[model samples]
Target: MLDRLDKEFAFGREALDVRAYRQELLSSNIANADTPGYKARDVEFSSALAGALKQNGTASNSSTLKMAQPVSLSTSSSLAVTSQGHMSGTSTLAASGGSTDDYGKLAYRVPSQPSLDGNTVDLDAERVQFADNALHFEAGMTVLSSQIKSMLSAITSNS
Candidate 1:
């Protein structure tokens, strides 16, 4: 059934979503690299993925999930506003892995050197991270495609 397929491929689906979120975050950092007071942000992908699995009780490896860094902030709590007049447009990092709002947990990257503008984005680091993530994302896609193909082949053979 569809549920069986979901159980088999949920991790892949979640991973792809996570990777896309990361790509957006990295792209944002790169876009703001030249802007003043922009802080480079990245997420703990492994941890976020683990948290999600734990939430669903479908995690194959609980020990590895524990190794993932804790998501310190919850989007719901941060979104709570005291009054209608209060300004609350700050894009907060959602605790990745469990919630629907998992836009890669926004942790500020420490700057290699202090900038006069207080911008923390390091172009070189962002570039490397972006490329690495993209490559990994592609790898995940390849594996998922193979799995789907094999499943379809088995179905056709049985029929």
Candidate 2:
């Protein structure tokens, strides 16, 4: 059924989303390379993907895969309430953006060499990471395409 297709394609879809998010982070790092005190940031891809899938119950139970809601790393919430006090007043919300529970959360990168300006971005490293992520994103697309073709072929031949 279509539900099965959803489950089957979920991994590829999720991987693609994560890859795109990583690309964005890397691009930001590259763009801010010259900004004083701007720390380079990146997600731990595999762990982030795993965490996202787990949140959706996709990674743990194939039986529940069809019911699982999709989770995207790139579009995750950056702002959240710090306490009930924030929710008490309608005028303004006291929120925090430093949650460790964030899916595909960005982590500060360690520079190979320290800079006097306190910037942690290494242009060479960010560029290399960006290139690698772009390659993986394309590769994920290819795999997804293959899966779709196989599914379509099966359906057409059956009909």
Candidate 3:
């Protein structure tokens, strides 16, 4: 289903989603640059990607283990959400791996020169970052499109 698609195109799909979200966050920051006491917000792409990869790896390993088990194994499964919102699950193989701290997580890149009003939406820096993210997003989308086109060609050629 859609979950399978997400897992299969994990990096490309998730990166696109995160980049889109980051774009929105950055735009909001820029829009509120003149607003007092507004702190700029951005997505921590590295940690998010790492979390997604860990989840996908766990799911793959669990599925493989299930295939090896007997039909009547009757194992119980449970999913636990950590404070940082990462999903952990227990299965027949072993317990969930490890927990992460939200406070000690990656910090956002602060503006080089903060404003008197405490707004940190450096227009120049934000413009550069927006361009870079857009390029990456387009690249990921192009790769995904090529993959789908190839799959379609394969299916049609066999007919």
Candidate 4:
């Protein structure tokens, strides 16, 4: 049913959302590189993706069991701030095969060269990282779109 589709696409959807968030954060950092006390922030890409995967797995498993009021798969991870001011968050998923723990959730890269005013935005590095994140975001979108198209085609053919 529609619920299954939503669960199946949940991982990709979350990835796209996180990617957009990262892009925005990176853009803000680049725009305020010269601003004092502006700490550059970004989510840990690998962990976020892993968390999404875990959530999907958990949801699917819960669905099969017919549990009354299945646990929400959108639980947010704990935030961890490193000594250098980087923040990390974790997301977990429960699955039939096994549970997945997504370490390194949301984290900001500590600036290699901290400004005297405590600013951590490195113009060059932020720009490069932003571009890379954008590329991955676009790729994720493409994959999701293709999957949707394939599913629609399959449904239409059957009808």
lDDT of 4 by residue, 1-159 (tens): 756776667667667755766676788889998898988888787776666555545434454211223234545777667677765656653332212233235566787987899898889999899889989989998999999999889889955
86-152 in candidate 1: lDDT tens per residue? 8775456544444534433568898998689999999998999999999999999999999999998
Off by over 4 Å in 3: 1-6, 56-106
lDDT of each: 0.75, 0.74, 0.61, 0.68
- Identify the leading candidate in terms of TM-score: 2
TM-score of each: 0.72, 0.74, 0.63, 0.65
Per-residue lDDT tens digits of candidate 3, residues 1-159? Answer: 544544455556555655666676678777887898777777676666555445445334332111111223324877767678775655453212122221124345587998898887788888888888788879989998987788679769956
- Return the top candidate by lDDT: 1
Which 10-residue span in candidate 2 carries the lowest summed lDDT?
91-100
| lDDT, residue 86, model 1 | 87
Total backbone clashes of model 2? Answer: 0
What lDDT does model 3 reach? 0.61
Q: How many residue pairs clash in each candidate?
A: 1, 0, 0, 4
TM-score, model 2 to reference = 0.74
**By lDDT, highest first, what's the ranking?**
1, 2, 4, 3
